[model samples]
Target: MARSYEANLETSDELAAVNEMLSAIGESPVNTIEGDSNADVANCRRILNAVNTEVQSMGWTFNIEEDAILTPDVFSKLIIWLPDYLSVKAPSGTTVYVNRGGYLYDRNAKTDEFTQPVTVSLIRLKGFEEMPTQFRTYIIAKAARRFNIRFFGAAEIEASLQLEEQDAWARVQEFELEYGAFNMLDGDAWVAGRLTR
Candidate 1:
């Protein structure tokens, strides 16, 4: 299910890097199963195993969450690594090359009384041509950097399409990721993440 594309699209490396990173995070599949609250270590193992299946089924594609990392500097690396066909332009007008989809917006504007547009643009470099799907790479490259990553929820999915659109706006119509769902681990996020790898 990999989407093939032009070799020289913008941010190809960074995009590839992100893709590579995701491929690394969840490649090793472990088997486990789900159980009631009393489920012990064995059950946990089962759940982990199930996660592996989840990843395999997904063909290893992952979505980086955090609405764009909290630290703006982190994104600079991506901007610097992007190819020419695509470019990233921050709300502040800071620009970079990127080919796929990116979301850049100010979080401080999310409130009701906000004066500025508390929204971001989900930029797409290609015409829904490519998206990452390497399981482990997807998790590390995409899930780890975000403030929180989440599984594509029922609301975030549209059964009619079977998959989300290359652009989140279209996909968003099908599934959703929420803040509360994320679990805090070691002062970082471990929840709101998907095993879709």
Candidate 2:
């Protein structure tokens, strides 16, 4: 069947990612992704989500939030739920915070209960559409490579796709360096070095 460019114009959504995966495996593009779909469509969608989550968990500048205020539960006055937080830090305090069971757990206090508001820096997972074009492109490329391997297991094709994935990753790393403004002075290692000196 002849495909219209208009139908595939919006390329930032999960459907586009799955369709790209389909195309990578020499399959026809799917129009829409839904629960009631073919096995390939379902598997592609699942793999895409898994890959997206893995990528976002790396704490990119786009996904990380700084100085976020989290309040305790109104009724219980404890257990601040942060279901989307992949990584978290107290920022500046005696408390050591960790996300456990989708809630804020205090390692210093040995409890999940919080009596007052807490300020934290955290990385949260974002949906595919919410990602910038660069990130989305990288994710789509990586997902396609994985999808190709799962169904075909063709060595030559997988090798070529691995290079594509690596190139996409390099672009993402460059984007991160430009936008993340990473500095050795800002990290804990530098602070420890100064203290020792």
TM-scores across all candidates?
0.16, 0.83
Worst 10 residues of 2 by lDDT: 3-12
Instruction: Count clashes in each candidate, considering only residues at least 3 apart in sequence or on different chains.
Output: 43, 0
Candidate 2 residues lying further than 4 Å off, grouped into runs, are 1-12, 92-102
lDDT of 2 at 24: 78
Q: Model 1 scores what on Cα lDDT?
A: 0.29
Candidate 1 weakest lDDT stretch, 10 residues:
78-87
**For each candidate, what is the lDDT?**
0.29, 0.77
- lDDT measured at residue 59 in model 2 versus the true structure, 0 to 100: 86
**TM-score winner among the candidates?**
2
Residue-wise lDDT of candidate 2 within 1-197, one digit each (tens)? 74321122234376778888888777998777764459998888778777887888888989989898888988776765545677777876456688667678889878887788888878787766677888888988898898888888878878878998899899998999899888766557768689778
